[model samples]
Target: MLRATSLSIVLLALCACGSRAPAPQAAGVAAPDARGPTANAGNHAFQAAITADDFAAHVQALASDGFAGRGPGGIGEDRTIEYIKAQFARIGLQPGNGGDWFQTVPMVETTADESAVLGLKVGQTVQQLTFGDDMVVGTRTGQARVSLQDSPLVFVGYGVDAPERDWNDYAGIDVRGKTVVMLVNDPGFHSGDARLFDGERMTWYGRWAYKFEEAARKGAAAALIIHDTAGASYGWDVVRNSWSGPQYDLPAKDDPAPRLPVQGWISGEAADALFKAAGQDLAKLRAAAGRRGFRAVPLEASASLQLASRSVEKHSRNVLGLLPGSDAPDEAIVYMAHWDHLGTHEGGTGDAVYNGAVDNATGVAGILEIAEALRAAPKPPKRSVLFLAVTLEESGLLGSKYYVAHPVIPLAQTVAVINLDAMAPVGKAHDITVVGKGSSQLEDLLKVAADRQKRRLVEESHPAAGYYFRSDHFNFAKAGVPALYIGSGSDLVEGGIAAGEAASRDYNEHRYHKPGDQYDPTTWKLEGIVQDLEAVRSIGETLASSGQWPNWREGSPFRAARDAMRAASVGSR
Candidate 1:
């Protein structure tokens, strides 16, 4: 049976809706036996191999001030990578790719100077918008200076160019050397159902990164996204912090997205104001962005931003370990977690380390634990098992993006990817939430393990978050590999769904991506962490042993990609 501790989550969620502070957490007395279920036989062995106390200790060590928040290119990376390398060593797994465990990912770190202005012109008015308040801009451009003053601006609905859905926002508009402004979330977000773009499932089209790339491919000088709390999954402050930090991008060899001269976000308030200035109603424009053949509307406004940035090119490693399979070591099952976090911004708020305890320290720890468990098992997996601790996941999933572009093992032989990002804290829940549930058959295996634990398969409670595209697994998914990204369920101990939701809501506001996310023994529980980690690990191990390479669920967008890969594999061989 399944059992979880169900600890309270300290998520510092900043309700992106600009709503008031979340309703108060109702004080409820403790319930008997917070654990939900007990592991039986095989699961019991797996559970014993991983425990809550152990998880806490590892997370505490990683999230502690010592790691300095584990940001990339910082001193924290030194300690974090060593720790991961040591963990793989302790687990007794062989170096995954070639001889060395380190897959050197070349990265360029860029930090934009704050005092710059986007010399924007709308008709007779030449307004210079400030960096943090009105806008947040940065570039992947290798150039020293990028100027986009007279570059025409166009509103390209969701900025999606999907032919299958018969929707192209860029139709009849040549965005070359222009700036394309688009909405944040998918069309279904505002229109609900009966509209295109995955209804409300948040296809890749809605992602801000996709907007920039699509605009860039269309030869746009810049791309801007109108940020709303609900659509972006966080507040403008979140946007500011995420944008302001030192950004890492995979080197050009990593197929670096064609850098737009300026890629930035405008606050919802600023966007509304800009809308008014351009004679386009924000509400009406949002509605228009959802329909088919949405045309790009010229804002008749021009944005010119000069970003002065300090560029540093450094190399970070994606730690990889291999367990060669029995029959076909050529084929493999992959398990992954990102090793990077916001890191120490240094003197900022006296928090030098972004220990990323919950943000992902738990996931890295989970990978280490899984590695140990698999190493101890008497029978090796039938296909190889690749354990990867990727770098720069916090920075637009650059590490995984690099790996897929230049795979140590062929992407064709790579059967599936299991990703751990921000696992459930030390609490026991009655269910698990698989983020992109319908994408692959891995969820079925997860279901088997969850059933063994007596837990239910919970549908994602917040699909609008676009969490599927937010993590490292998306990089693999985009390259035709089926991926599993499971998140902790929102079912609490004494509170059921309400209690769990309260903790989740709290953490998102107060702790998410902040220094306040340090490990706490008193307020947190690692029971759930161990439980879910065990669940994901069990699935990976099972897949590695099974001859079947798993399948995407019917009607899954990833299914076509998977099927195409299968055909290509057969034809090539």
Candidate 2:
């Protein structure tokens, strides 16, 4: 990340149409007696204090090769945590986690041996599936060796058990000690009928994480997700790259949720061949699964796999810095970004470093730039602002989930959580995209802020991808806290929607989760990131100064948790 020297320079060079002035500052720290400022004062200072160069400088440092992709429990983790801590100190922020800058997150790293092959038996024919090319498998049970021999394979469509939706794919089927083969997303996603499981919008049920969880709940010995590019959003290469490395998760004891002995994904070709051997057509079966009242079907096959893995217990650090509220010190607003990435590849070809520049380095840099702006403001926020950089987001948001369970501040006192992930370096846009829109009341506050910048708030364009549940903010949402996750819109102010879409497509296909995602100062346009940071700052400032507590909207899955928490608080008082 590089910091722009002057707003005037940015306006002249980056913003061809028009630009706003960077925030003004007095430079020195505020007096001890100085009270927190009103929303308007903090908003004004934040507008001028945030600059393009500062954002770039932070991203450049975090995404640098010296950090080694910011892998957890390695040299990269040590350097990444220290860098964030130093930035917090330089910004004059206090420790957020009870006078400590670090919170230790316990995790278990499991690295599977790739030489192993999966056995799929159909009638008299048995096929061996290659590791990376045909399939990928790993065990979350934390065992050194796991085996599923001659386990009956059953095709469970979508593998969702949502009682509220009155749909149960596992109804009347006993999958104990069996292997479940399921689709990537939910039923309605493929059909595009809103009446069928929320239509195009992906519920939590559609996510791969949920699919595995549901399979385990039904006592399945193992689970395998059939890969479909349109359904999964990314190609099979993404699945291969993500699952091939050492996978990290909260220790088995730490998470009491049921887990299958083996969880994996198979390539489309492999799935098609298996289905053909079972005397069924994969495409036709997928179509039938989308409709209501679909039952689980036995595939007339068995799956056998022996997963050999080395499991080690390790500790990862979550870096936190606090700007304590002058009035309501205990109540807070949180800004989060994940500092961990794919790290360096151990046994691979070509480029080894999976430098997650746009994936998260930009997000970490963006939050650091915002923290600096908040520190430089004339007055502090009435409610504390916590700048949290978590670990293991790529590993199922484990760091954030741990923080939610063991919060630095009580969830009830926490006002809101704003998460920034993968802010594209594309230039200014006509609007901002709010992932998981219409889930909570925080969007109302975001709308007001976006309107002030003459920008509109648009729902995420790819709902089937379930981008909302894919980020750290989802942990907060699941725990009853209203959270907002937004990114630079794909409708560029200069080139319009087509240009913005092209950049998005290019990143997702060519650079995302790959070694090509390196920091290139030559081509990056940070003016748009600056714009996004300004809007994010305004939203946080408004919530920090106000007394209102935002909640999930009616009918939201999280609404009940918020209501129950409120009722319990009242009963205690």
Candidate 3:
């Protein structure tokens, strides 16, 4: 899981959101037998192999304080990958990456000096904003000292430039060498207007990563997104915690995305004060920015920042294990989960290890259990199944991104991706929440599997948070592979939505990304997660056993890429 960077606190409001229509069932698809996969004795064997006890054991071992929170490039990472490799070997999976169990992902880890401050000069007065309080900034250039001098600031509405939507915030303004200030999310979010950019449901443009990328493309010297709880979907504390530590990025040769010299978030209070100091009303500008044809607003201020950072170049590993197919071994199905989390906080008071028990010790355990089940089955599928436990997800999905770039199997021949992240342990539920539902045929497969369990599939309660783009599957999705990410549904079979909501809220407020996220067997429940793993495993098994090439649905942003790749694959043959 990627922490609060994309997980919405709005998930806590699942109960209050009222009734959501059931996800559209895949047409003409017959549900599997509810008694389990009994047609083939092998299928039944695999199903029986996935048990609550085994899943719990994996979680316990991975989330144990001895793992040191599984931080990438640390001792925790060493133990974590070795543990995964050992498990894979025990389960009879072969090395997936060219006869090697590990794929080395080169990364540059940069930790910015937190004592640095952002200085805003409006007219003759200079207002200084403290780091971690008023603003959080970092440099991707891998520089020790990144300085900006008197860079003029321009308020770019949502920092979006979608020509298809007939909207451009930087239409007449050249932001080159200037600081581009923007609001969080996209134009449609705050306005409540479905006519604009997918309405409340966030598009790719709404993500902060997108905003920064667009700003970098425009030659901006610096980019600052004004943070609001509703817009970013998390609080300033999340931003502070996530950004305050060492940030990781792939080497330039590997990732080639436009790099920003400096970029970060500004608190709403700080943004308001800055806007007022520049003789602009933050509220009014926000409202105006939501409307179409909104132009950039140049603030009467210049910004200067001096950032000092400690940079370390290191290599992380993505642990891979393969169960080769009987027929089409080259064609593959991928089951992935991020294995890294916020590691032990140096010099912290108490309970420093961010165990990430739910954020994703659960997810890693999930794939392991699924792998065990498949490996124990009487027969292998026609297409290979790859169990991937990736690193640096907390840093930004870096491991998965690298894998997609340099894959063991070509992206064109890849069947589909099933991602498990932050699976809620809220016991058995009546339904499962599909993050970014209706985007692919994978959901249809999931729906059929859910039907077998007497459960329904439902859309994530808060789509505006863009949970789809948050996880590792997103890297595969962006590359045109059909990817599915599902979280445990809040509609618990015992307590319904209310209990689910309460649990979600408690996790978000108290434990999420904190030391409080330790594994507690006393309180932890595994039945629901077992069901989730089995359901997703069914989807993977179905894909592996057949020749189906699942794809992104029409109108999906990733559809074009998928169509192009498939076409090219056919033409190449």
Compared with the true structure, all predictions reach lDDT values of 0.73, 0.79, 0.81
- Tens digit of lDDT per residue, candidate 3, span 467-529? 777778889999999998887787777777777777777788898777788778788787888
lDDT tens string, model 2, 1-573?
011111111111111000011111112311111222121112222233778766766776677656667778876777778878977886889988897999999998888888989999998789899999999999888899999899999999999998888999998899999999999888998877789887877788988888888899899999999998878766788788777767888887777777888999999999999999999998888988898888999999999888899878988999999999999998899999988887776544566666677868888888888898887788889999999999988777889989998999988888889998888787887788777778889889888878888888887666776677777888998989889888777678777877776676566667777678888989888888888888999888887788888898998889898888877766887
**Candidate 3 backbone collisions, by pair:** none
**Residue 15 error, candidate 2, Å:** 30
lDDT of 1 by residue, 1-573 (tens): 012212221221121121111111112311112222110001222232777765666676677655666666655666677777766765678887798978888987777787888766788887777888888888787566667768777888888887888878888989898888889888888878646767876778878777788888889888888888778767788787777746667666666567677888888888887778888798998887776656879887887776787767888778898878888899988889887777655333344345577877888878878877787788888888899998877677778888898788888889899887777573777778777667788888899988988888766766676767778888888877888877667675556777676676567666787767877888886777777878888887877877787877888766788788888998998
* Candidates arranged by lDDT, highest first: 3, 2, 1
User: Could you tell me every candidate's TM-score relative to the true structure?
Assistant: 0.89, 0.91, 0.92
Candidate maximizing lDDT: 3
Best by TM-score: 3
Model 1, runs deviating above 4 Å? 1-48, 567-573
Whole-model lDDT, model 3: 0.81
RMSD of each: 7.9, 9.5, 9.2
The alpha-carbon lDDT assigned to residue 549 of candidate 1 equals 79
User: Of the candidates numbered 1 and 2, which has the greater lDDT value?
Assistant: 2
**lDDT at 541 for candidate 1?**
80
